[model samples]
Target: MKNNTYYRLTLLAVILSLSVTAATFGQGRQNRLTNSPREGYWVIESQPRQKSVALFYNDDNQLIYKEVLSKKRLNIKQAKTQESLKAVLEQALRQWAVSQKTGGNPIQNDQQWLAAELN
Candidate 1:
């Protein structure tokens, strides 16, 4: 019962957080990237003092990839712009490309994803 309650609360918190985030685009404070769309679909979740989490979802809404962007590379100031958002996504892929444990042909995966997104 206790575990179930905890799970419910956790789920509720996530739903609330997503709804609130979906409803707002306030700058420099949890800004959701806009004006840029791509294959599958990707979202940048940036928070102050927190390394932004990037989630890429397929057309069916299933998550495809998840990565954390570099703290030094996260440009919150320009994240709202289309070009900036693309750059941020590229940055995440570039970071992923170098990972040994990134699983499955990183270069091919990175190139394909980048081509799909940028082209």
Candidate 2:
């Protein structure tokens, strides 16, 4: 019984240590964009064919936050122009920041924002 408990405990510790190490290394190796068009506002982190991950920054270029934007999340039916897409992303980020300041309560319906953005 004693040997079984020790083995289980050792296994748990190893698993936990590996998880922490992976998380730390992953954060240290973030893939930041080198030539984002919206450099002043946000940096594109990852852009899959359909979805995009972005990291917003303040005026001093300090990382403010991150968000993932996709057509499904925004309820968009068609493709958006580049300028319009940037505007929508900026607006979503601002709304998210405000929501965070206000106790993380969702501010409005996502569909509402999408409709307003699309139009």
Candidate 3:
């Protein structure tokens, strides 16, 4: 009887350990877009009338981090390893700056203006 009880207890312990391990592993495998990465891009919502842009990069799974460039030239670099996204963001900013300098709005409502500037 004692040997049977011992065997049952061992089996229970093994099952419990496996359950715990499986739970932990499942949690670790969450969607990358939901869990912020140590490096990459993420998109966040902005306030109304706030001209903001977010550049994101993922490890083909989750967004690691982001670079948020605001309208007031607020350069906030949140990710460490998204150089390509950063370059594209900077290019967009440069284009906007040039449009402002040239007294032309890059994002105007007029279709002609947009087509000319984009082209």
Candidate 4:
């Protein structure tokens, strides 16, 4: 019973958070992204001193990929604009690519490494 209550509360928090986040963007045409219309529904959740989580869902509402952008993990700034958001996603993908090459060890959040990759 206690475990079930915990789960319910957690679920409620997520729903409420998502609702508030969605409301921030407004309705109808305002909700849609002009930069990447082909990508489908994308949800972004960001909070103070925590990792920014971006969830990309397909047209069928299936999650395609979820990226966690962390200052601690990648030293990246908060994604405030469309370009920055794309850069964060690209950084996450780049980390995945590097992991594939290096047998899955997590990469350090180094500015120098990121700068080299960008160049």
Candidate 5:
């Protein structure tokens, strides 16, 4: 009887641990930006110490631009043109919004803007 009880307790503990871990993982993803409208210009506020990447898109869902605004160096090798810069800015803004909702510190600098201009 004692062995059976011990086994059951162990199983319960394992189940509880798994549940807690799953919950945390879900929360982490929720903290990041997910599916959001890829239209217009967005303003992104990133953590003072981290680099931010924003993405901009046109009405047809084409990747028009991308930008990486960072306090540190951001190695963007494929970004060219204003469109690409706009795409990057939009994505960064979405991420910043999500981060803010999830308890991340507000962006300290107000220098980032992502605009998706129609061409």
Candidate 6:
């Protein structure tokens, strides 16, 4: 009975450790786009391959502000480290915001829309 209890405890510990390790490395060191929402600040809604859709809510979820962003014009690449990719995304966002103010449609230019992404 003592030996059986010891083995069971050991097995549980090993399984737990393995799960933790796997969870830690699950992203696999890629510079993937993470849409970590900034609560009570601002939110960007990305629409892929479309002009505009009639949204139901179309408003911030009780947050500060919200805006629609076409992914066809922002951070449309996967060839950089996470930090650099974040910088590029920020620049693209700024450009998109500007375009919105000037009443210039974003979906016009389809090839690498953001100037920052071209750099």
Best by TM-score: 5
Which has the higher lDDT value, candidate number 2 or candidate number 4?
Answer: 4
Residue lDDT tens for model 5, 1-118:
9999999999999999999999999988775435334455533335558866554444545433445565543333434434445455555556556765898754433234432321
Kindly list the per-residue Cα lDDT of model 6 for residues 5-107, writing each as its tens digit: 9999999999999999887787653323254212212222446575321111112442211233343333424544233334434544554557679977552
Inter-residue clash pairs, candidate 6: none
Off by over 4 Å in 5: 34-55, 63-73, 76-88, 91-119
Estimate the TM-score of every prediction: 0.33, 0.30, 0.33, 0.35, 0.40, 0.34
What ordering of candidates by lDDT runs from best to worst? 4, 2, 1, 5, 3, 6
Per-residue alpha-carbon lDDT of model 2 for 1-119, expressed as tens digits? 99999999999999999999999887666632322334346455444457655555545575545555574233223447344445655665576568768877653433344335556
Clash pairs, candidate 2, are none
Alpha carbon RMSD to native, model 6: 9.3
Residue-level lDDT tens digits of model 1 in 3-25 = 99999999999999988886674
Clashing pairs for model 1 are none
Per-model root-mean-square deviation over C-alphas: 15.7, 14.3, 12.6, 16.5, 13.7, 9.3
Per-residue alpha-carbon lDDT of candidate 4 for residues 1-109, written as tens digits (9 for 90 to 100): 9999999999999999999888876764464544444434556677777766666454567554565666423323544445454554455555545775889765443
Against the correct fold, how does model 5 do in TM-score? 0.40
Model 2: number of clashes?
A: 0
Q: Which one is best on lDDT? A: 4
All candidates' lDDT scores? 0.54, 0.55, 0.47, 0.56, 0.54, 0.42
Q: Which regions in candidate 2 have their CA more than 4 angstroms from the true location? A: 1-80, 107-109
User: Any idea what lDDT model 6 has?
Assistant: 0.42
Q: Candidate 3: misplaced stretches above 4 Å? A: 31-33, 36-79, 82-119
